[model samples]
Target: MAGFLTTHVLDTARGCPAQGLTIALYRIEGGERRHLRTLVTNDDGRTDEQILPASEFRIGDYELVFQAGDYLRATGQAGDAPLFIDEVPIRFGMNEATHYHVPLLLSPYGYSTYRGS
Candidate 1:
């Protein structure tokens, strides 16, 4: 699975999977951003499926935006005026056929992401 890109979201404040959270995938081409797809997290706090298949992997700059504010509001984890970070864009290169496991540790006020195995 080295050629695949995957992600998981965990709500640190709640200590559970951040189900129903919205995420988006994008690729930069010719200085224009293209919307690859939008996905909602499953009960396991993971995308319904892999964002990008291994066969379709390519070497380029990619971004993953996690809709934290809306998720918190809908789940009542945060208030309507939640000081949530709406988006977290992760820019990276697919230099080779490698699996990119991007995991997000999130809270109402902050979030963190990193390359995972």
Candidate 2:
């Protein structure tokens, strides 16, 4: 899975996967955001499958939106206006057969992401 878009969410505050979190994938087409698909993280804080299959990958600007606020509210971790981030958007490009591992370390007050292997 080194040639696909994958993600994992860790709840730093709770020290576990941010399961049940909604993630949306989008691509910029004609200077606008087009909805590609949506997925929910599993018990392991990862998508059930690879987001962008290597065979169908293309070079473009892509976005991954994480609904952390909703997840926190639903999990009773915070209110509608959580102190941490609400939606986390990661923008990147796919120019070759490269694995894009975007993992999020989330807390009630902050979050961080990086380009993983």
Candidate 3:
């Protein structure tokens, strides 16, 4: 009965978890997007809690936005370099009342995400 959404981020370029990175979630309703919440990653590159609480989890489409540029820039590696992918947005849908774990592997120029445990 306990089901929710979660996420983890990794800085592939740096070979470590992306700490202090910012992330946001949005719910898509009728083609319009509504903001859910924004969180900064902790030292482990994860939010303190589930992104979507079990009580609020519903069957619908959602999008997660990662502030890749800021994360890269914060590391001081992207200095004076034009960011190729500033914001990485991932859109997905949920059809079951199960835990959705989306983890992101990222670099200054690219990122990848997938459904995880």
Give the TM-score of each candidate.
Answer: 0.91, 0.89, 0.95
lDDT of 1: 0.85
Preferred candidate (lDDT higher): 1 or 2: 1
Q: Which residue pairs in candidate 3 have backbone atoms (N, alpha carbon, C) closer than 3 angstroms, thus clashing? A: none
lDDT of each: 0.85, 0.84, 0.91
Give the best candidate by TM-score.
3
Candidate 1: regions farther than 4 A off? 80-82
In angstroms, the error of model 3 at 68 is 0.7
Writing each residue's lDDT as its tens digit, candidate 3 over 1-117 gives 666999999999889999998999999999999999999999999999899989889899999999988988889757565778788999999888899999999987678888998
Cα lDDT tens digits for candidate 1, 4-61: 8899999999999999989899988788788888999999999877987787788788
Runs in model 3 deviating more than 4 A are 79-81
Among residues 3 or more apart in sequence or in different chains, the pairs in candidate 1 whose N, CA or C atoms overlap within 3 Å are 2-98, 2-99
* Candidate 1 vs 3: which has more lDDT: 3
lDDT of 3: 0.91
Candidate ordering by TM-score (highest first)? 3, 1, 2
RMSD of each: 1.6, 2.0, 1.1
Once superposed on the true structure, which residue ranges of model 2 sit more than 4 Å away at CA?
Answer: 80-84
